[model samples]
Target: MEIDIKKHLTFPVFLICFLLIISLIFIFPALKMIVLGAILAYLIKPIAFKIQSKLKYSSVSIIIAMITVIIPLIVLVGYISYELYSVVSTIITSGSILDINQFISQCINYLHINVNPNELSQSVTSSFETIISYVMNYSVSIVSKFANLSLDLFILVCSVFYFVRDGDKCLKFIKSFIPDDSINFFDKTIEDIKNVLRSIFYGHFLTAIIIGIFGCIGYSILGYPFGAFLGVLTGILQLIPIFGPWPIYWTLFFIDVISGNYPRAVVVLLFGFFLSGVDMYIRPALSSHYADIHPLILLVGFLAGPLVYGIVGFIAGPLILGITYTVLDSYRKEYLMGDE
Candidate 1:
């Protein structure tokens, strides 16, 4: 009886089975966090590397860089939280329902629309009471969320440190198994990934910082309450493409109008328009220079991110698009252009 090993197992079949088992093993417990950490590490690796070059140790450099990034973020969040609490307390204590109602009535009058102030004031007061109640109820939930977020952030920071330190070793170990002929292709793919991450970071972050700074300055100049907080809020809103900062400015404008601060409001409104326009131009230019991806692709990714990944999705969205573009470009260059 001639026993044929080929009948029991083929090389390609065995390899596929092994890969499937390995993939399942690795992708189950911490896949999402791993993916998030990897993306974050990729974006920050350049900074880590720069620090490492100076300090001569990846681990130490990463720790320092992580602290540098984390501390400022913590301070920012703390400041914002404090400001939010102050605003909430002021709103609750002042009982400014009447002022708001009077402002609304004046607006209606200016627009030549007749309305009943007594009825409107009563309705407004009711609504304000409901809002306060809702806020009180929501406070616990928000606190719980922050607790969970803090835990997640701890994990994320630890993961990023390890990733920055061992990422290259991990890549090389994995790539070693690939056929020698395909090594160049794998290397190019990794390069594309790095480029995409850098592009996404450069594009979104720098623009957000600029907008936030300008917004804070503008609000302070106009003597808006909680100007810094609102400015930061404006920056966060700027992540949304096309119409991010408009609502913040518009609300402030309306508030000023009701307070009989028309000149200040008008000036703010104009400044807002200028800032918004500058963002429209600056964001795309910065993104294009870094990623070289299509504007429409970035725009779509910006819209799609929050829908897909919640808040983190916004960053992930453009990143995915950038990676896709880079990979396709690489493939075209290698397969199609070379053939031509």
Candidate 2:
């Protein structure tokens, strides 16, 4: 029996797609949180399974796993927030103009610059105050949206729990929709996606952690105030492709030069170079074992993701691009070049 060309399938397919679009529209607001939850769940699954082996209750195991994983993250964020607030508050209220003037005077003596120290100091102080004030106001606005943030968090938690527990089922459900002939392609694509995930997670994130730890140690040893914060900033910069740790180190070096601590400045600059060199070796060594994703793909993802999805884009953007690349590559290999 020949199936009707447009009688049975077209309307149903159209209706399904229409409904899907509607569903997506409804969920769009919380989409990023949900996506983040799924990504986090992927990371948490192995831990949850190990816990489940002992507890024998999936829900209990997942909750325990989440707590262990999430608590440290929450603490870190809280610490960063507190430190930022304290720093900003101090800089704003401490009448930094005198300090700026002194620094500018030192610059004049050291570099033989003929510029007006007072005027430059006033300009710099004004710019810092304006930026700090804007940041404080933004923070206040975020706090004002606490209720919406709480709802999003609630949804994220639920998503992670469900994804961790029922992830296999979800995979199976998705697999069932694939045609038999395309199953191999689907499977290969999925494996490649996994490799991409491992590449990004281990290669980028772990590298950041190692760099951050070294930064904390090196900066503290170098006697920089807020060494821990600088280290954290260094680690975060390590995640960006071109930025790396140079900004922090260069700023420190300049500060030292202005303050007539040339030796310490040189030492910090060298230490910064070491951190950058270590990244060159460490990132490739960790990521290459899983997948050798192109730097451009990741770079674009990192740069453009935040614009589209806010902060979560940092995670999702690279991932989506990497997965898309893998899928296309898989298709080419499995179908286009299969005979050859």
Candidate 3:
């Protein structure tokens, strides 16, 4: 006798299978853009709300928020990119690096390495040529990358708008599928995730800006022509975790000391070392009273995120890790501790 297939496929089972299929169809392909949209939504949410208070229109508020935030951000990025291009171009074009090469030779000799200066110079020249060629190729590919990035940005914007506007509905839809008793656990896990992401992203960004301000002052005082640019660059570097401000400031210090500017070198030394050390204190200072966010998650997210997930991996990586951590911790509390 032929069994009834429709009878076996109950409503709940069919719904589950349908949802699973839907996720498979849409989730992975759009995951990166979705993650980016979440970040933008979180960041601009306050602005969106504040504007909505006056306008009372969610769509208009989102539009205003995007303009307010994204416009300035684009301008700032453009400025920083131009400054970086100028600096790199100047360094590559300038032929007055005899002193720098000599300093390298001295350092090599200090290590007691049996290396020829001419060969070292030639190796350096070859490396520079390779870098130049790579840069040229990268420049050629940038247009296509920009187009792709732009499309991603548009999707992100639309996603952010929906997330901010219909977030409650979305959450309700998710929770509707959860068992009533487990809803509390699900919400707790989500709360933990938000706290972690917010703490890491906001704290790191604020810390970087603070360091950038200090760096700008120090660079300006040092009579550096690109003080503002370097200051901004230092801030961007602060997002890198451990080796943030030291490399730039120390290099500046070295150049000064080598040029007989001992006092200037000492000042840069003090500033760089101090600014570099601030990350340790700043991270904890910015974490929420209830949330003790560690730097390791953000660092790992930053370093390994891009490697695994491409550019969007930066946000997705940490988010995935953070959520995993929360889930495991909750499981331990609920299931493992139940034995006790």
- Which pairs clash in the backbone of model 1? none
Q: Could you tell me every candidate's TM-score relative to the true structure?
A: 0.83, 0.93, 0.87
TM-score: the better of candidates 1 and 2: 2
* Residue 118 in model 1: lDDT: 77
Off by over 4 Å in 2: 1-11, 89-95
The regions of model 3 sitting more than 4 angstroms off are 1-12, 15-19, 92-94, 97-114, 145-147, 288-290
Which residue pairs overlap in candidate 2's backbone? none
Q: Against the correct fold, how does model 3 do in TM-score? A: 0.87
Winner by TM-score between candidate 3 and candidate 1:
3
Rank candidates, TM-score, best first: 2, 3, 1
Give the higher-TM-score candidate: 2 or 3: 2
How far residue 167's Cα lies from its native spot in candidate 1, in Å, is: 1.0
Per-residue lDDT tens digits for candidate 2, residues 31-60, read 999989989999999999999999999999
User: In angstroms, how far off is 257's CA in candidate 3?
Assistant: 2.1
Model 1: per-residue Cα lDDT over 1-340, one tens digit each: 2367667588888999999999989754444456678787776788888898899987888888877777888998899889988987897799766567778788777767677877877887789789979988887777878966676667677778788888889988999889987788789988878766766666777778899999999998889888889899988888776657898899888878877888998998998898888887887777767567776787788888779766667777877887888888988999889999
Candidate 3 per-residue C-alpha lDDT over 15-98 given as tens digits, one digit per residue, 9 for 90 to 100: 999999998787676667877787778778899999999999989998899889889779988998898788777876885367
